[model samples]
Target: MPVLVFGSVNADLVFALPVLPAPGETVLAPGYATLPGGKGANQAVAAAQDGAPTAFAGAVGDDALAEVALRGLREAGVELGRLAWVPEPTGCAAIAVDRAGRNLILGGSGANQSARAAQVEDAALNPDTVLVLQREVPAAENAALILRARARGARILLNLAPAGEVAPEALRALDLLVANEHEAAWLAGQLGCGADAASLHRALGVGVAVTLGEAGAAAATAAGPLRVPAFPVRAVDTTGAGDAWCGVLAAALDRGLPLDAAMRRASAAAAIACTRPGATMPRAAETAALLG
Candidate 1:
């Protein structure tokens, strides 16, 4: 089965500093770098690197940064046949990382906002496909993808990051929902459900995974609730950790691993992601090393 990611692609600018800036505060950075990022792009790279046959469908600008994003995806062996070239600049993220490995980010939607409802095609979907989606693209576009995938019987994995109002139709179409702590709480409030993974799963009639950072993750599966512990690792930068987990989890599940085993691989991949800077995804060998 192929994992198809429909999300944003961005060029991430990272500044490493001694401390994070406060409101109206200025900080000096001793290190800087640029990397390929975006919730969709990072997950696509992570999935491909984690040994999944992955494809990415998103928009990028006709700019140098687009080349960077494309390079990263290609290097990770992600199929790019469905990627769109738009007139706007590639999406961008400015990240500030403190010595503690915590980060603050500001994103510019740029060409991501150009993803349209018409971009979805039936030809790209099938029952064997795992459709990976995120909120980085326009809501209507995401909804259209969900509808198309649902009609084709493709399993939908929706990563509701930076969450807000989601269309009920889209919500109902999801087979799985992955969210971080904050996003999960907000989503629960919106749906009038309790702030637990099991409650959310029961309310939405879907598998729910709520990531609790260092506390690891909790999931409500058809079998029952499960908790996976976070792997211990020295932190460098936590950027894209969630993307790593989501992508690896999707790939592992597509390979027919049970949810518990899949989440273990996802946890290992995420732990490795924290040891690197930017949105760098570990290769299969690297994750294997971590798992050992």
Candidate 2:
């Protein structure tokens, strides 16, 4: 089985500071680094590092920063045959992390917004394929991809981050939907449903996983609800935790792990990612050790 990530790739500018700057207040960062990231790229790297056969489809600009975004993905063994080169500048994210490990992010869409639907559908989707998606790209493109994947019987896993409208066809096609607490609430409102995992699942008629940050994560399913406690770890930078979770979960599922076991493994991976400085992911052995 293969996991295909149809998402964005970005060159991340990370600023480590004592505290997040207040409005109209300037704060000097103590450390800074440029890293490869983007919800899609991060997830693809996470899945590949976790020992899954992963492929990534997206666009990057023809610029120096583009190499920064592709390096980590290639290092993690993700196939990038579908990544497109466009005229726009590469997408970027300016991230500020405080001593408490919380972060504030501002994104430059650039090439991400320029991604085409054809690039995503270029992959050979099938029943054994898992299509990982996020909101960083255009929703309409995602919607079209969902339809194409569904028609081919590929499993669809959607992460509704930075929540917004999803086409009804795409919503109904999802095999699983992952969201944080705030995103869950926003999705529920958008779907005209109650603001809870169960209601959202019922409304969308799919499995729903709600990430509760430090508290943990819960999922609503046909069998019933499942909950996994967050692994206790010292926080360093929480920038890519959710993306780690989404990627690991998709990998676990593609490897034939049961849903509960997959969620637990994903939780551990996310916790480990929280202990790192950027969107870096652990190797398969490291993640397995954390699961134990």
- Write one digit per residue (lDDT tens) for candidate 2, span 134-207: 99999999999988998988999999987888898898889999999999988877878976778988897889
All candidates' lDDT scores? 0.89, 0.91
What digit string (tens of lDDT, one per residue) describes model 1 on residues 132-165? 9989999988988898899989989999987877
Residue-level lDDT for 82 in candidate 1: 82
In candidate 2, clashing pairs total 0
Colliding residue pairs in candidate 1? none
The window of 10 residues in a row where model 1 has the poorest summed lDDT is 115-124
Where does model 1 exceed 4 Å of error? Answer: none
| Each candidate's clash count | 0, 0
TM-score of 1: 0.97
